[model samples]
Target: MDKQKAQIWIARVLVTAVFAINVQCAIQFIAWPESYTYAYQLSGASAEAVVRGYGICFLMWNATYPPVIAAPHRYRVLFIVVIAQQLIGLVGESLLLASLGQAAGLGTLAASITRFIIFDGAGAVLLVIAFALTMRAARSLKEPAE
Candidate 1:
């Protein structure tokens, strides 16, 4: 297969994995909101508000990913947007843990946070590579070998 095709397939596969994970999270939030709230150590009122809003937001944002995966070239801008969101998520999660983890005693949530960091971090890295390859592939078409 060609480099571009390989890159596209790689990105799609990685993105599908991320999508699947998000689906699970959304389902958990929807199907067991109270359980999720307790698992995340959130209070009743706040958990109710957060789970409802954030869960829907998560579903909505994730719903945009399939189009990008289906046609990366057509959705190049969205690819960048996805990359940015992943970075923000990773950094924001780490910052939250760093700033409040100690104070809040987040050790009990190590496994939970670790899974998020791993998946988000991996997804970000894959998308970055895919973007670079896509750019290179596009440029190669415009500038032939010297």
Candidate 2:
């Protein structure tokens, strides 16, 4: 496929992967809250409630992604919003890592924090790359005939 099409496909696939992750989070929180919370080493009162709430919030935000997947150009503006949201989550993840590191020390970081860094870091990287490619593709498409 051509460059523009490849760029668009990359954006769509990246967004779809994000949406799927959110869906899995929501489903897991609802169906297996305890198991899900285990990664964070959470237990006792309010752990499940917190996890479920966080998952549901992700679901709400992820609802916005499908439109972008359909038409990256039409939803090009929304891509900024998506990136911002992901970046914000990364910041929160960073804070969590710091907090966990402090609490557990370097020896045993919470599994949840580790998983977030690995998976979410990858997603963040892909989103940045997809955004750059999409922007380049849009710019090239809009240039006047050479």
Candidate 3:
């Protein structure tokens, strides 16, 4: 396979992986909010409700991924948006984790937020790599052949 095709494939794979991870999380949160509340040491109906709400927001956020994953070259601009969103999630999660530092009884919540930070950070890196590869492939296609 040619370099451009390979790059596009890699980008698609990366984006798909990220999308799958996010969708899985959303499904779990929505379908079993109680699981998350238990993991985070949260209690009561309000905690489960909040978890479900977060799952809904996650679904809304991930709605942007499908078109781009379907056609990375055509939806190249969305890569930027995806990367920006990943960074935003990473930073926000980090801030929240920091704010919860060393608090007794909130350790589970902090750990859960920390996990999100790691996931978002990794996702951002993958997206950035994919975006670079996609851009390089696009550029190669546009350039005059030697």
Clashes of each: 0, 0, 0
lDDT (Cα atoms) of all candidates against the true structure = 0.71, 0.74, 0.87
TM-score top scorer: 3
Question: Candidate 3 local accuracy as lDDT?
Answer: 0.87
Across 11-56, the per-residue lDDT of candidate 3 in tens digits comes to 9999999999999999999999998987677789998998999899
Per-residue lDDT tens digits for candidate 1, residues 1-146, read: 88866766776777777778877887777766777665456778778677767677778868767876776655777878878888988897777666655555566565556667887898788778777765665565443221
After superposing candidate 3 on the true structure, give the runs of residues whose Cα lies further than 4 Å from its correct spot. 143-146
Candidate 2 regions with alpha-carbon error over 4 angstroms = 104-109, 143-146
Q: Best candidate, lDDT-wise?
A: 3
Over 19-123, each residue of candidate 2 has an lDDT whose tens digit, in order, gives 688688788887777776656566765888878887788788777777767776566778777878777777888787777555543433366666776777777
Name the lDDT of candidate 2.
0.74
Ranking by lDDT: 3, 2, 1
RMSD in angstroms, candidate 3?
Answer: 3.2
